[model samples]
Target: MFSRRTVLTGMAAGLFAPYFHDVYAQSSALPARLVLVLECNGVYPRALLSTGTRAALGGRANTSDRLFWDAYKDTPLVREGDNLASAISLGPLAESAGKIDLVNRSAVLLGLSNLIAGGGHSSGTGGLSCAVNGAGATVDAVIAPRLRRGAPFDVLRLGTSSARVSIVYETCALGPRKPAGIIVNPSLAFDSTFGSLLGGSTNGRDRKMLFDFALADSRKALAEFKGNSNERLKLERYVSSLESLRTREDQLTGMADRVRPYLPVAPKDNPLLTGAGSPPDSLKWFEAQFQIATAALLGGLTNTVVLATGTSGFDVAYGPDVSDVARHNLQHGLDAGQNWEKVAEVTRRHVQLVANLARTLAATPEVGASGSMLDHTAIIFMSDNGEQHHSTSREWPKLVVGGNALGLKTDGRTVVYPKYDAPRNRQVSNLFNTLGHAFGDADFNTFGQEGSTRIAPGPLSELYG
Candidate 1:
């Protein structure tokens, strides 16, 4: 007969023994991954649509009429016009258009209003995660625990800007108002967040020493809190968070070991990229982060990630000849011919980011899986507002990519909702709830009040296989 202490020790070892090996072949099915790419301000809807009168003059004025002018009624927005064939198009994403059935793989929910009654960037942030009324969890937070289970690095919030207001959430409804721990200084040590298990580059023996130290410290901390009632609860949560971090560190170390041999060593003069003056470098770093995030997901290190492209009123100079206008101002110039061209350029840049992520996922072979990592992950790309000036959420430019292997049809079909008055439109919460349902939360209906009251029923069924 086994003693209780021996039995418990055996159970613990059984749970963690898999960490000793790559464990990629342990499961045949890859875990579901969710990534949300959020662009500050809003997307220029006109850049997404090619219908209605393209005349430079004032053709029609009704906001409702503007909604129907887009190609959602007859064809996917990508096929609407010739100018958009190359400009403001999904670019390389065109490859994914027919391979996955749009009608079966994805759904576009247009005309959904952001019920939040405030104005400007903060409100957009609030509306993007929590509903307009500030009464629901961000979709990323809601689905994180469910999808990854005990995996480390459940949700990573990353941003390019130093402004805390842009990257962190103020609303409590979005999930406990925990500080996001934003990585503003690119030079900041990754060790601070992922050091213990992976170790730092000081000494040859430091790796094993650090891991042993972390384990001892964790055990001591647990033992100290065993007697204190209130302290025990706090320690429990701390242990939980730390354990998750430990798993992440282990997986990251394993992946780094595997990929480091194939990667070029960092150049001595590789200054950390920062600031608006370095758009090209900024774009490169952004792409690098996306690659890192994809690698983490493929390695089972994390299941959810939120990436912010630019913050509200983000003012980055393109060049001396180009307009140095901010994102919001540039978006407001949608009706102007030159402004539309600029908008198309910006939209193209955004699409390029998506393309980079998609390509990375497509390239990574899933462990113990037949398809690529891209086939198992669902990516939602959206902006806070549909257009620059309108502020209304009607005819919002949103896209859902990947997740085909997890029962999503991604052929790029556009689904337009019946026109409604601005107030009665589907709330952005609908998208949040729909995402939750996709991750296997069957009870995930009615996010915000406006979402429950106004949005169409349940998840958008058109995208599911």
Candidate 2:
């Protein structure tokens, strides 16, 4: 009666029974919502720090703009450990602007590896597994099956930009050679997900009849309750709830107009609605996608969402003065200045969007709890590529925010593993495994294929409080 999974899980438990006896447990029935922002074209981890930390750590920062340096910059690291959570900076406006402390609650992971993905090549599931081209399910899909139980959608994989090259655009894999489909059209995504409530499901009369019938049925049931007085009171409350449902439905009928503005703008003079339907690689399109994702999460349509944008060689603009340039070219040793500025700019923008989402969730109270929903949610910001353009798969930096509800240690502590040459260096698969363990899935001792890199089984013990 034992399947391969059961056997593997049992074997793993026996191996780690001594060290992880109490570390492993069942996944919480109320797990945190997952939002994955998959960045392409690598990241400049050194540029994110200050000159003092960068000098000690030997990083890159070739900027002459004092105003820029004064603004969107922070060391976040020291000789010993990271600065306390409050000292962390959010963006260029952090010094002058006052906002929420969402950024301070973030964690940065250094000294991580994939050992499988080649430079300038998207790993697909290879990032999570040794199987190339997503021979197995990636980390997001692995968590989706359990986190999104009974949700309207299994996992909402969305992105900006269509394929301009024959790279691994699809990150989620169903199995070997099977990449999950991603919806690149923003307007279509909105229509497919919320169209029913937007008057695209049934005609007005049919909808009215359904609501009317439900109300009448509930009222009749309330009148004929022949049980105890307490039972009669419950029936009356049920009848009242039916009437409330009708009011909510009527409110939804008129909400489409208000919702349209937040969606992608339609093409000019194009009846096919080509522009709006397609999620182009523009800032507006990305924001619109964020709006749709926020709505889906808030509406309880999906529990896990993955959003990806651009690629390594892709061209993008950071500032008004800075023209569009290819990220691959800028990600070099001598060209570190341009790369530092652009990466910082892009990261600030994306993190601002994350801040917006966190703010929205923070204001909204949890469904059946006392604190806000943000207390039970987590967001991961990581690059599909590693720490440099045309990376050697040596380092994959990551940022995780707001996983306290899932038992994660997110006290703004920046954890940097030893260098690859050092003894006991770790890879990202262990981080993914650590995540799986946090989510109560100890069966996945290690994700991906058995590549040449040496990796130990089990999660990073320091990541938990």
TM-score of each: 0.70, 0.68
Cα lDDT of model 1 by residue, 1-465, tens digit:
222222222110000111111112122134678887755556654444322223311233224233443322332122212222221444445445433222233333444555452435535445455445244455655566676655555565554442433233332123434323333322221223333333334532465456557767876888866477787887766666556445555665565554333221231223333333544233434444554454445445567776665543344335334455654566566566676676566556666676666655666665555676677778887765554445554445566777877766565554444333433344466666666666666667665555344545566555553
Model 2 earns a TM-score of: 0.68
Backbone clash count, each prediction separately: 10, 5
Highest TM-score scorer: 1
lDDT for model 1: 0.49
For candidate 2, the 10 contiguous residues with the lowest summed lDDT are 12-21
Runs of candidate 1 with Cα error greater than 4 angstroms are: 1-30, 50-87, 95-109, 117-119, 132-135, 162-176, 179-256, 262-282, 316-323, 328-337, 420-425, 449-452
Q: Tell me, by lDDT, which candidate is best.
A: 2
Q: List the residue pairs that clash in candidate 1.
A: 100-411, 101-411, 102-411, 102-412, 104-409, 105-409, 105-410, 106-409, 111-395, 116-132
Candidate 2, 99-162: lDDT as tens digits:
5565445566666666666545455556545455556766766676666644445566765544
Candidate 2 colliding pairs? 72-92, 129-448, 130-448, 130-449, 135-176
lDDT (C-alpha) at residue 232 in model 2: 90
